[model samples]
Target: MTELDLQEYSHSLLLEVQADAEAEGTTTPEAFTRRVLEDLEQAGVVANTFTAYHKTHGHEVHGYGVSDSGDTLDLFITDFHLNPLDSKLGKADTETRFRRLLTFVRRCGEGFGQEVGESFDAYDMCAAVGKSLTEVNRIRLFLLSNRVGTWTDVSANELDGIPVTHEVWDLARLHRHATSGVLGEPIVVSFDPPLPCVSAPSNEPDHSVVLAVIPGRVLAELYAEYDTRLLELNVRSFLQVRGGVNKGIRQTALEHPGKFLAYNNGITATASQVEFLKDADGQPTHISRVHGIQVVNGGQTTASLHYVMFRDRKDLSQVSVQMKLTEVSPDQLTEIVPKISRYSNTQNRVTLVDFSSNHEYHVRFQQITRSLWAPAKDGSGKETHWFYERARGQYTDGLANARTPAQQRRFRDLNPTSQKFSKSDLAKYVHSWHQLPYWVSRGAQKNFNEFMARIDEAQPRVDVLYCQRVIAMAILFKAVDRIAASHGAGSHKSMVTTYTVARLTLATEKRVDLDRIWREQAVSTTLEDAIDDLCPRVMHVVTHPRDGAHVGEWAKKAACWDAVSRVRWAVPPTLEAELLDHPLDEVVAADDEASSAARGEVTLVSPEEWYAIERWAKETRNLEPWQRQLAYSVGRKLELGQGVPDTQVAQALHVRNEAHRLGFRLAS
Candidate 1:
């Protein structure tokens, strides 16, 4: 917030960019832009396909991401400067850069790829944009810079009749985002005519509830403008399925518009602030505007409204939908928003792990990382913690909490910035090692959601060994990234890295001795050699897409992984020599054995408890049919005064644990 603080953040960010550039053998500007894009992507400010392209002509594009719906295109341009944290980006320079990016978009729409060959890095981006031009309804031009500047807001314009908006994320803005833990800028919605709403009586002082019947047409229009920003708190994206809720929504909108209110579950929304339009009698009559409005639930309904209005060309004049808007205070936004989202989505198939940053898995993982220090690497003689940022902005918040420079330095010493990894980073590493490179390529947030779903189902124990293996995977991923960069992977660096690691994991059959890597705090030279030998093959498969498809999009497909998996590259003998004799299962079994020993003896449940558990599970519908049957069988065995097998006891315990996780409360 202060000038000194901004300068410090800028300097730290610059250093990080330089370090990444050095590691990847890339230019500082390229690294800086990539880092910024990664932050924005994780923040949900942008979607997938982050390709870097630069042109020397009056046109240039640092990077771009197409929204999940393929209707919004985000174009990024950066003005990165070396040193001089006090440097300022003026309006003239900003406009010049903006125009250059605009020219690039215009050229793409005008089929500029025909002029340049496919060998160029920008060719794929230009071609993809050109192909999606018809579907793209909005263009967001972002100006990323490390310099201090007064942002001159650009009014929304049209690009080939499609709406275009401009935004700038300068040093101060990035610093604020890093520290504040908020996802991008707040979306302020101003109603032109204002809608009537009734305030719900709430005794709570920190928040207020309002009920409104929003016109379906107005809701569609709002979604058309805000898109996913309105659903930032929502866990899922637009399902886009023809059946289920989407189909029913479309049918209701078309056949029984007036019944939509009675048929639909409506939407649960939250906002930081709201303005009321009051009458002369000092009674609030209309809701005028909302600040930081996010639909925590009913994202499907909101997106369906937009879908029907645009894709089906259906008039929503007769449709009205109910809405419950909770105006939360800024102080409670972080604490209450996720709870609101979680509880509202419980009725759906969404589980507790869907909103899982604060889940026990991550909490235990974070605790393990904090307590378990990694071995000193490169003769540093001092161990460091691989800080697992379970929540966003935690590492920075930790540094901020240090207050003084000395404390901050000690904090950095104990937890190096390079060692700091977020939940998405962990997901990417683990998923790549698990041979799901396609999932890794699906962007951070989505891939993380998928990974969390798996964690929810598997319920893997998070212990010291698990933390070590995760860090080992992280080290492997980073090593591959560096190798890919050194080999001039260019825009395909990420895909190449993930695929190469995946191929190695597959070739080795999950026997790579992650414990050794964890002990050394680095990868073996033989393993690095194996990765180096396979990087070129992976790059070839990634760069040469069949039918000349976009490499980025191709990498996100299972077929891409399939093609890479079938490559003729074999694991080097030396690398194979480094692999463990048994698979990772053996290691996990050993850990389970030690964990079991630590817990002493497993107490067998009494027949009464087994019967109670079975009854509770059946009543709550928490267990699958097979699990319920197993529980019932065990209960029957206990009732018959017959001994139950240890397996059956374990099964019953698992069922009980799962039921507890699903919120099946029992009388103590």
Candidate 2:
């Protein structure tokens, strides 16, 4: 065969392989789609969870992802035996397949939060992310297949309701994106007639400051188009500081629309490129598409505009807000982006820890990891050290310069499993292990910032022991993750994926005698065996939800941990020998003994409220048990003033209202 023909034939063979694999097990396509969708993360898509089901309401959804921004994606991975557009196929067959896809989109849209799918409870999934049909700004239907084709029928691109958009990710497209390292196009915000703007040159010619009066309606439209992608990390936190409409911005917009520019500080935005539509005399007419749009400041104003217009359903045609657009060249993005984020966000301040990577915690972790050595398994006297990567590319750079065999061995000693653990990974594993999956699910950067804040409040100074504990927790998490993957592939391949394994880890951690486990300074073989035993129970808890609770929400919060921790599992007989003579046994035993007396006082939720809560939960049929449980926990915290100040009263009230809507009752 000719080279081109050979290439085409090889493509056909690969598609056949994918089709065969998918048909053999339900997880094949789910896993494949997950690997493919992970690429979207580079494009700024922060997905919290993935769901895979054999069938969702009599339709095979294959898999889907729920983003942190409350957007839902319906994934369909098609691995057909024959190409639908083959010459042997009749026109009728093609039409039928196309119409079937349209039906799938409609079905997915209609069944948004329903639990008819094989994945986790959709209702619980939506509730955990605070998403509802009304709140879901967009529903993306992604059709992925090995066979290449375009949807020439433009009419079938979107569903009528819920702002649904369709996309096709064929094998060719996936290959290009994966190989080229190119991101999807940045958002383009255009202003017709080129709204008048003034420009000031910066230090670099490629970078300039353009001041323009953007229509409030246009800004809201831009927000709707980009969602959370537009907000810088710090800006997202600032907007989330309080709930409900900004009374000041609202009053000004509602009462005096004309004074919006004068009253507001306006939004500060960054873009990779900006163009102006100009007249013959070179006077600017309006803005063309502003590429790579990001809001470094004025996230409140941007979000407030969307909320006021879409949520409040208010008119914004008469309102116009000011915008300072910083056009940045691609080459200077790395250095300039952080600076823009820092200076533009003066009103809603962020700290050095939030933006910079040169924090003391990272330096301390590097020291701890380098100083500590892993236990020698074979009694060789030689031990491996865990290389805690404080910065990106540090490991690779070190390995590249290794000249001697000892140096090479040193490089290898930094175990690969633990090598990639960054501060973000530390935040994720620690929070998820400690029963804070909700924060972990909020995207890595957001979770890292929160974890840093917690560290600041709880332990202003880092110590060796605390760093050791963090490292130990990460090791355990990694061990569990590997075991889960092995089990999924070998035993329960159809029912498990990495994401499910994470959820299962959270459940298993509840059953784990943390008091006992923590005593062992390291993740030893005995703890691994214990985790293996706990996996079955974790799977049971995940697949079966007691009391009709929202399992997803329960799993995300500490309430589930509080419930599961009450149960104590005896040591598995098979691992008793290993546990008895474990190297760290004495230390662990000492810690456990010291903490045993105070265990009862360590409850996160007050035991005093149990009777009243149980009665209230039993009486309230409107709310899911999980909702009741969550509300009670929040209520208890409110009573205890658990870090919540009077300033957070409005947000607290909003939480209460959400709980009530979900069927939690108000106290008389």
Candidate 3:
């Protein structure tokens, strides 16, 4: 927010990157580049198939990501400096880096895989990009730097008639994004000829509502340009259910374009700001531009429209669809936007699980980490916290919130950046331990979504014991990760580590004493030895894909897991002796105490506060119809000064909790 804050953030980020390199046993430059790519993937700035490859001659490329449809390719090049905080990437250097990345793309399009031997790490990526060139309509070249950059404008060029755009994610830009509450870069849509719209009457000042009929052609074009960035808030991916709504929408768009408005549910969108064109009476009549526009609902409809217009080459000139656009202030974007998305899609059976970050499970898990302290390790008497970053920038925010140098130092000592883990990291650890190695091998974001879905189904209680088990899982994962790095697993290290853990779990029958691990804060040496023994065997199975398939892609398949599972590497006798006699219980009797304490805390909220929460939920539409009725009943009972039963109180508390999670705030 200020110059001093920026400086502190920059220094902290560089230190974190260096710490990652040390933990992963890689050079700082490689780690810095990989970290940047990982962040970009998590932020939805790039697709998930990003692989790191650093090879330079007359051209260079650090990493590459290919879209699922094969229509978009992203290439990255890094420019690292020793003194990143003080260094700056000038315009000329930026242009040169972009050119190098473009040259690599050009070569890949021209079948450079032949020159790059099949044995090389990058050969598969090169060959794939070369083969997919015909389908690739756009290529984005990124220059990743830890230094500040003087270049601001993104230059667009073409290679072999395919549009190639250049972007630079320098230190300052990366810092701004990290601190900002929004996801990825904002999509600012400017209409060449403003569309006429009618503003809905609204009593709220934080947001305004508008109703309009948008041209189907315009929607398709916008999708083509922005793609999934337009649907960032929409958790649902475009599912092609046969003969379902998607197919019907496509058919209607092609056969009855003029009737789309009458048949479809249209789209619900949000914007942080909007420009209006008013008539002589000063009444808003048209929308000229919108900032931070995101489609929260009707993703299927939007994607179907894109498919019909672009893939099918259908005329959408006669197609018009209704749209409800909510212009929310920047301050309310994080809080209100998710509620808008969740409520708008409730008719489709979307639950709070779809918004996993805000789910009660994660919220409780975050609270546990904050309150629980880990045992002191390495003979130090000081205990530290393993910080679980439930949301992005929280760990940094913790540091930035400290008012003085002494407070900052104390914060760092307690919650070291090295001890920090994200939701994706937790997903990878838990999924690996559960013997879903293939899913873990998939990139972080995808694996995290799958893990959340499983969590929804299982509905495990988030108590002290559960939190300890999660930490034990984290400890086990990091131990295996370090062992894998030591064994020269190289690019296949992640697959090797996950498979090793999964195989061990299967062999030992999930009998590891996670409670022991949590108390001791370290894995037993015998167990580490067993992991060491399994690493090379797992590596062999993962790296040697059947039919010479790409190892990375193959690692994501069930067959790979099956092959690794079939390996005859047994847990060593010593480690087997250390395994627990029985599997850990799904629930502990002690957790009931914790649950009762939680409920007691909930009941501590005064009746007046509950009434206020009900009113807020009503005004904000934060609760479901059923939940709203319950809230009203609770309010009525409180108003009548009648004692409410514990069951009714708990239900009311649940409603209030859900509303709070969705950003409902009672008047102070």
- Best model per lDDT: 1
Question: What ordering of candidates by lDDT runs from best to worst?
Answer: 1, 3, 2
Q: Of 1 and 3, which scores higher on lDDT?
A: 1
- Could you tell me every candidate's TM-score relative to the true structure? 0.85, 0.63, 0.84
Ranked candidates (TM-score, high to low): 1, 3, 2
Under the 3 Å rule for N, CA and C atoms, how many clashes does model 3 have? 0
Residues 155-252 of candidate 3: C-alpha lDDT, one tens digit per residue = 79898888888889988888888887655889999876888899888899899999988899988888777776777777555544232467789999
- Candidate 1 overall Cα lDDT vs. reference? 0.79
Candidate 1 weakest ten by summed lDDT: 594-603
Which residue pairs collide in model 1, if any?
none
**Per-residue alpha-carbon lDDT of candidate 2 for residues 16-66, written as tens digits (9 for 90 to 100):** 345434433434454455445544542344344344433333344444555
Each model's lDDT comes to: 0.79, 0.53, 0.78
| Per-residue alpha-carbon lDDT of candidate 1 for residues 92-169, written as tens digits (9 for 90 to 100) | 888888999999989988988788787777778888878877887789999999888775576678888988899899
Q: What alpha-carbon RMSD in Å does predicted model 1 have with respect to the real structure?
A: 7.5
Instruction: Give the Cα-based TM-score of candidate 3 against the true structure.
Output: 0.84
Clashing pairs in 2: 194-285, 194-286, 194-287, 195-286, 519-588
Clashes of 1: 0
